[model samples]
Every structure is written in C-alpha cells, then in structure tokens.
Target: MIKVLIADDQEMIRSSLEIILSCEDDLDVKGVAKNGVEVLEFLEREPIDIILMDIRMPVMDGVLCTKKVKKRWPQTKVIILTTFDDDDFVFSALQYGASGYLLKAGDLDTLHHAIQTVYSGGAMINPGIARKVVDLFSQRQNTPIIQVEEESVNSLSELEWDVVYEIGHGFSNKEIAKNLYLSEGTVRNYLSRILSKLHLRDRTQVAIWAVENGYIGRRS
Candidate 1:
C-alpha cells in the first residue's frame, strides 16, 4: 500500500481527505497534520511514501515545506493539492522538486492517479497548471548552456537519451519501459544513472531540463 500524509491547515480538509483516501485499498492514510511543522514532526517519527500538501498553511507554507522535505527526504514524494493555482505557486513548488501539482477541485480518482504516477517515478501537472509551466520553461529554452552541462549531455549513451526523451514527455517508469522495450527495473537503473550524470535532483528537474534544453519537440 502507498503510505500517505495529508498536510492542510484546515481541520475539515484534513479530516475529509483522510476519509476519502482511506477507502482506497492501495492507499494508506497514514496520518494527518495541521501544518508543515507538524508534518515534519510526523515524518521524523515515521516514514511516509507521499505527502498531499496544501499551498498555504499557518507556520510553514507548502512551498517552503516542499523544499525542506525534498532536501531532507529525497525519496518521499510530494503533490501540491490546493485551491490556488497562481503562476508563482505553480512554478516555485515544481522548481523546488514537487512531483505533482493538482487543484483541489479534482476528484479523488485524479488524486489517486497522481499519487501512483509520482510514486512510480513520473511527474504530473494539472492541465491548466501544465500550460503555465510549459510557457514559463519555454521562455528559458534560448538561455545558453554552459560547457560542463553540454559535455554532460554528450556523455549519455543512446539508450540513456531514449530514457531522457521519455521523461521529457512525462512517462512513468512503466510507460518508459514499454515504449523502449526495456524492463521497468532497467528503466529505473537508467534513470538513476542519468540523474547522477546530469546532476539533477529528481525526475521533475529532468523534465524541466529536457524542455528547456529542447528535448520535447524534437522527439521522433
């Protein structure tokens, strides 16, 4: 089962999400927190696979919390589930390594799918949020690449390049494995090595790097 933590400032939202998500057999609503501070405290006590975080909170907001979570627990995935979809919120949260960004208006099914997708090593963005992300990153496509990063790109094997291309398109490990005719484990191994080579923190950054570096449109 996918272990989860719900972090929202409101008591009703926290309780409602806990109830709704608990019905799923694959999901385990491990705990709930009133704010990021409590979320961190709970995490310190136990391991959680995912965190459904709200953008705004009392002591610590979701965006800063996301950055801290990623830095402290890289394996723990975070999905921003909130009513706010402002451009700054969308951009900063993802830039700080949130695996997914979704609106609270979406159904439980969408939330569940996002959890599974990010857990399985893919990134998700709400369609409206995705457009803003694309436009934002597209602006940086013309930015110059330094020699070191260019050399790092050159160091990747053809198979690794295939994985990068798939990641750019937001394919999960399962999808990338099927598309490349490789095993899922092999795809994961490729991904790990790619991250090490490129000095990227996670798949989210890889996707952004792919788009900014022109991997999306050129895919064959």
Candidate 2:
C-alpha cells in the first residue's frame, strides 16, 4: 500500500481528503497535519510515501516545506494541492522537487491516481496548470539554457528519447503510454532510466531541460 499524509490548514479539507483517500484499497492515509511544521514532525516519527500538501498554510508554506522534505527525505514524494491563483507557488514547489501539482477542484479519482503515479516514480501535473507553467517557464528571461551535447543526447536509446520528448510536452505517464503505444509501466521504467542517464533529479527538471534544449515543440 502507498502510505499518504494530508497537509492542509483547513480542518474540513484535511478531514474530507483523509476520508476520501482512505476509501482506496491501495492508499493508506497515514496521518494529517495542519501545517508544514506538523508535516515535518510527522516525518520525524515515521516515513511516508506521499504527501497531499496545500500550497498555503499558517506557519510554513508548502513551497518551503517541499524544499525541506526533498532535502531531508528524498524518497518521500509530495503532491502540491493548489488552485489556479497559486501559479507562483506551484512553480516554486516544482523547482524544489515536488512530484505532482494537483488542483483542489480535482476529483477523487484524479487525486488517487496522482498519488499512485508519484509513488510509482512518475510525475503528474494538472493539464491546465501545466500549460500555464510551460508559458511561465518560457517567459523567464533569466532561466539559463541547458546545453546538452549531441553525443549526450544520443546516449539515450530511441525509446527513451521518445519518453523524454513526451515529458517535455508535459504529458503524464498514462498519456505518454497511450500516445507511444506502450504500457504505463514501460513508460515509468523509461522515465527512471532517462533521469539516471541524463543526470536529472526529476521529470520537472527534464521538462525544463527539454524545452531549453529544443527537444520540445510548441503545443496548442
């Protein structure tokens, strides 16, 4: 089972998410926290597989919390629970190694799937949020372009390169699998190998690298 922690300041949201997530057989709702501080405290006592974290909180915000979580507990995946108004915070969390970005308006199925996806070593981005993130990333003039050599790029096998291009387009593992006519498990394996071969930390970095190196094309 994938162990999960719900982090939100609102009592209703935390309770609702805990109840909804507890219904899934594959998901185990380990605990709930009211803020980032509580989240870190929970981690001190036990290890968790994923955290459904709210972007805004009282003491420490989700972005800062995500950075600390990644730094101290690299294996614990975090899925930012955000709204459309939290564009800047969302991007900041992604930069700090968050594995997923999900809207509070998302359905139960989406939430459950996001946890599973992240736990399985894949990244998930809500489509609407993804488009905005891509646009925002492209607009940053100070973002340094990553220069990947042809030889380095060619080191990835053809199938792995296909996975990289799909990730660059911000396609999730499920979508990439359907488009590439491969199973989701295969896509996940390819993504793992791609990150290892490219010396990247996560798929978010891969997406940014792909855009910087011209591997990704404009999406409409």
Prediction-by-prediction clash tally? 0, 0
Model 2 quality (TM-score): 0.88
Top model number, lDDT? 2
- Cα-lDDT of candidate 2: 0.86
Expressed as tens digits, the lDDT of each residue in 142-163 for candidate 1 is 5522112778888888888889
Cα deviation in Å at residue 219, candidate 2? 12
TM-score of 1: 0.87
Q: Candidate 2 at 138: error in angstroms?
A: 1.4
Off by over 4 Å in 2: 145-151, 154-158, 182-189, 212-214, 218-220
Candidate 2: residue 85 Cα off by (Å): 1.3
Which candidate has the highest TM-score of all? 2
Could you give candidate 2's per-residue lDDT for residues 36-132 as a string of tens digits? Answer: 9999999999999999999999999999999999999999999999989886686578878998999999898988888888897778889888778
Estimate the TM-score of every prediction.
0.87, 0.88
